[model samples]
Target: MTALRRLVATALLITAMAMGGTAVAWAHAVRVSADPAPDATLATAPTRITATFNERLQGDFAAMTVVGPDGNLWSDGTPQVQGATVSVGVRPLGPAGSYTVNYRVTSADGHVVSGSWAFTMTVAGSGSPGPSATASTPSADRALPVWPFIVGAVAVIALGVIWSRLRRT
Candidate 1:
């Protein structure tokens, strides 16, 4: 009985360690906050858009764009990353309509994180529309290999079968 209990405890410990490692390996950077915020209604137009992430970002890999309601690009200049925050300048907004902000940034861990949000302007501006631009979609992260987990589970089952046979004998 003591031997059986020890075997079970050891199996549980190994399973826990494997699961913890897998969780860490799958972790990705997340968006913490944004300047105009998601679905916010602003009284006036914002000259810039800023997004904050939970992890440090690669400056060269960071990109953001502001799309006006008329299907025009309003984001001006390249995005700048300072630590975990990324900001991009925007041309004066035109008309009172929803503006979409799209962003993609490479996390410090090399994972790409991308998302889009929109804010509505209550008052219109005198700014003219610019060229059309496409927003980048979030690239899917690489999935962890499944063979190891399957093998580990099979081994655990085999161990249990062996233990059961020993007990019967």
Candidate 2:
């Protein structure tokens, strides 16, 4: 019975240590900071956007969309990830106005975090955000079949082989 008690104590210590290690790993992710500082007022257009997190965010696949005062999308591409930070390029503004930066990301652990922030630019006009990329839209060609490309490639190769054989004969 004494030997069994010792074993149980050792197992509990090991379990606690394992949970502690996982907590440390997950500690890498909370949002530590952001540029445009959440609700900053700027005299001019910001050349870039940045978000800093406590944990290392999943790098390449994070998505970001900035809706300009005109309601147009200002993000040029998928946000780029570097270390714990993710950033994206911005579009030039024709007018100064309020803009909202809507951020969404999935952490390395697969948890999705989403939020929005607004900033004012004194430079003076507003435009509709260019397009709604965050929302899904219906497409006209949803019923298209995938086999046509495969069949066409085979047909073309067959035709080429026949022509070569005929020439040889």
Candidate 3:
């Protein structure tokens, strides 16, 4: 009976620890809201696109691009970051189709997050294409390597196994 109790307690401990680690991993910055919003259909083109995250962002590292339906870039100039919000100016939109907004930002915790969203304009504009939609690959310094976390999880499981064996002895 005592052995069964020990086993149950150990299982609970492992489960709790795993859940805690997952929560911490997901505590990084996440998009809370966006201007024009995801999948929104608008009658007029917005002059700017904005993304709001759950945490403050690093201004210098925050970047965004607006892509038109013909695979041309409509975003102009560098993106501006204000606290948890990042925005970039958009050219007068062209074509009445899907436009994609791609953004990358560094959270206060120093983790980089990147994502894309699309919105449709009901009417097209006569604006000229700016550039092509090309996202810069995340720099090595900004990349979050997973090897360390894998090593830590393995070490934890190994320690748990050793503890169980020692307890049995």
Candidate 4:
């Protein structure tokens, strides 16, 4: 009975350690807030679009774009990263329709996080649209989670330990 209890305790500890490691490894930056907000309707066009993440962002390859209703890029200049926030200037929006803000940023853990949100412009603007979206748009491919593989390895180890102990009995 004591041996069985010890085996169980060891297995639990190992499982906990594996889960903890994976939790840290999987800590990707998540968008906590955005300027203009998602699905927001505004009377005036914003000068810039900003995205705030839950974790600090990396400086490299941080790209943001505001695509206007006409399928042209409204985002002007390069994207700036300040801590957990990433933003880009808008080149005066055109047309009174939906504008999508697409962002592809690198998280603190060197993981790539990308997403897009749209806001409606109730009023039209005088500023001309930027270049076409086809000319320049960063790819926002999401990385796959590795927690499942970690969990599987933990289960296998626990099962092997239990089986070995039982065979010894």
Candidate 5:
């Protein structure tokens, strides 16, 4: 209930809120759309696979690969980054099963975003499969979770409240 203690508690609460807001603001480019589309079933295979993100992406460190059901890489040459779209040439598709598209791209914020999605091919193509995907390409399972930071901020605010109450008694 003291003036100094109240000021300190207010400062902590404000700091925690500011940090949480910042964490939410810190974001990477997210895929807003795709060529074949996620989980889409296609009767005909497309020559190129493209993913459009929500924001602009960095031209450097952008890579994408399309893997056929045969477990071989079908992507040809290098992946291209144009504004928010990232695409790569597919060497025709093989097998009628599901095909996976993996991508690792740098966001305008300079953080790397990576993920994968699959689409089913109803009919197989005549083109041969490319070589297996190499480990050299950067791929990430997911982006870093922000829950921990939020939890920590909540804990700090809770502790501040508890300390203020303890000081009153």
Candidate 6:
């Protein structure tokens, strides 16, 4: 019984590890394009923040925010969704410096997604109107949770141990 359990436990662990790795790999949304592009200096600030993803997006854009260097919200309204393209209009930009465009959107497949970008404006126009910084802000955004792998791991490990113990006899 002991020997059988050990073999089963090992197999289970191997399977769990493989599945976890794959889950992390598959949960990302491939960004087709961004208006300013990451870390690009635009000839001029864009009037809108646009993101094109591999999948079509839904109307429920719960996490999009266009924050300027000064800590104010720049996105004029909710993001307008058209097919796979997502875009939000911006207020006029003030200074020529770095502006961070942070966004989170839901994919057609129901995945929660988030991302960000930075653009520099070299000249500040009078009343140009752009987003303001948050009371505080991070230079970039982070990824979301992976619940599938988390739940699958516990079950796989438990089953593997039980199977090994049963086979040992």
Q: Using TM-score as the measure, which candidate wins?
A: 4
Summarize candidate 4's per-residue lDDT along 109-130 as a digit string, tens digits: 8988998999999999998887
TM-score of 5: 0.69
Candidate 2 per-residue lDDT over residues 13-125, each given as its tens digit = 99999988796455435777888787798887776888888776776447667777655677666788887788877766446777777766667676666666778888853
On TM-score, who's better, 2 or 3? 3
Candidate 2 lowest-lDDT run of ten: 134-143
What is the C-alpha RMSD, rounded to one decimal, of candidate 2? 16.2
**lDDT for each residue of candidate 6 in 1-169, tens digit (9 for 90 to 100):** 9999999999999999998878655755657898878788865667788888887777774455677666676667677878777788877776667878877777776777777888787777444444345542332344445788888999999999999999998
Q: Order candidates by lDDT, high to low.
A: 4, 5, 3, 1, 6, 2
Best-fitting candidate, measured by lDDT?
4
lDDT of 5: 0.87
Once fitted onto the true fold, the runs of candidate 1 whose alpha carbons sit more than 4 angstroms away are 1-20, 135-169
| Comparison by lDDT, 1 against 6, better one | 1
Indicate the residue-level lDDT of 101 in model 4: 92
Residues 114-149, candidate 3: write the lDDT tens digits.
888999999988889886665432234556689999
Stretches of model 4 off by over 4 angstroms after superposition? 1-17, 140-169
Q: Assess each prediction's global lDDT (C-alpha) against the native.
A: 0.84, 0.71, 0.86, 0.91, 0.87, 0.72
Q: Write candidate 5's Cα lDDT for 1-169 as tens digits.
A: 6999999999999999998878635887889999988999999988899999999999987889988787888888899999999999989788899999988998888888888899999998888887876643445534568899999999999999999999999
Candidates 2 and 6 compared by TM-score, better number: 6
Better of 4 and 6 by TM-score: 4
**lDDT at residue 14 of model 2 (Cα atoms):** 100
Clashing pairs in 5: none
